[model samples]
Target: IAQRAMEPWAGLMRSFRAHRDHVWCKLSGMVTEAGWRHWKSQDLQPYVDAVLSIFGPSRCLFGSDWPVCLVAADYQSVKRALDDCLSGLTEEERSQILGASAIEAYRLPL
Candidate 1:
């Protein structure tokens, strides 16, 4: 049998559901070529909601990409980019995205 074609959405959902093995969602490069350029400034609520729909909230994470983010916005601007999207989520979810998810995923000592 031949290999399956790359379906980005299906693939992403599959990875997200594998949360039993891996927790946390870094939405850094998830958008399209054009979309990535605009993602930082645009309302990312839909995409954030989509991830919540598939993976729930506890597994989400935030990353600035610092250097990569510079392609779209300044370091501080990109670093603060997720503030709006995250406003709708619960405190627990925010905790995960801010640090808990990374701590768990990397098995880091906190």
Candidate 2:
């Protein structure tokens, strides 16, 4: 599905038109997909990159699935994993993925 969505002829962008106002969480389900016991940032980078490419920094938010993530890694470890995957992004783009996008997406009063 990720590959299909990334294809130019798949009309993924057109599908996104209906969700133009929505933001996408680049986190979630990664640890499980990568394998709970033997996951690394490198293992998850392809999936993360795909999402970032499709959604761009402005519409992509980071999510720390907390207790769920704990089953695979510690809180800091999970965060560091994502940080590693996002290492090449600019500071502003990182900020968007880390927090700014979530604020906008959720319409928070902060």
Best candidate (score: TM-score): 2
Query: Model 2, residue 8: displacement in angstroms?
Result: 14
TM-scores for every predicted model? 0.69, 0.79
Model 1, position 81, has a per-residue lDDT of 56
Report the C-alpha lDDT of model 1 over 1-110, residue by residue, as the tens digit. 01222357656776758755454567563323225455543455556666766666666667767676565666666546566667777888788877887787778986
Model 2, CA-based lDDT: 0.75
In candidate 2 the C-alpha lDDT for residue 27 amounts to 64
**Per-model RMSD to reference:** 6.0, 4.0
Model 2, residue 88: C-alpha shift (Å): 0.1
Off by over 4 Å in 1: 1-23, 30-42
Give the Å error, residue 77, model 1.
Answer: 1.7
